[model samples]
Target: MRVHVHPDRCIGAGLCVMSAPAVFDQNDDSGLVVLLDDSPAGADADHARKIAEHICPSKAIRITGG
Candidate 1:
């Protein structure tokens, strides 16, 4: 799936990073959501979706076509 993170909407809660570290991260400077992988494959893709649809408290993570 294609993962997108909106840093502007991030609250620095870090749920995305904790849920899917391979696809998301927290900026060291801003503590905002930092997308580590825009496109994930296999199980990583599913994991990204979970973070986007459920885990992200700020709704900073979004997923598109797989």
Candidate 2:
């Protein structure tokens, strides 16, 4: 699976960060969405994708080749 976050659409809700810290984080200055992992692996990978999709209010995060 591949994950990407749209910086322009992110609202800094922090939901994605809270859901999957290993996969998402804050940019500090702008507080926009930051993708920590482009390709997550192992057991936590699926969990990361699910949480990211679920919590993204703007739908900025998308999963491809699912």
Candidate 3:
């Protein structure tokens, strides 16, 4: 799957990082969402990414092509 994060829309909620640390992270300085793995492998990772996308308060995460 392909994942994308819109940093401009991020609100530093850190939900993505909490939900999918392997695929996402938060910048310590700016508190913005950081893309760790744009293309996460395996079903478990993909599921975690999806949870991140859904839980993001700012809806800054996007996933395409599962």
lDDT, candidate 3, 1-66, per-residue tens: 789899999999888887888888889899999998888888646665659888989989988885
TM-score of each: 0.88, 0.88, 0.89
lDDT per residue as tens, model 1, 1-66: 678777888999988777778888888998998887898887778778865548778787789895
The most accurate candidate by TM-score is: 3
lDDT (Cα, tens digit) per residue for candidate 2, span 1-66: 888889999999998888778888999999999998888886447766677787788988888766
Lowest lDDT block of 10, candidate 3: 41-50
Backbone clashes for every candidate come to: 0, 0, 0
Off by over 4 Å in 1: none
Q: Could you tell me which 10 consecutive residues in candidate 1 have the lowest summed lDDT?
A: 50-59
lDDT of 1 at 53: 49
Evaluate residue 44 in candidate 1 and report its C-alpha lDDT on the 0 to 100 scale: 76
Candidate maximizing lDDT? 3
Higher-scoring candidate on lDDT, 1 or 3: 3
**Best-to-worst ranking by lDDT:** 3, 2, 1
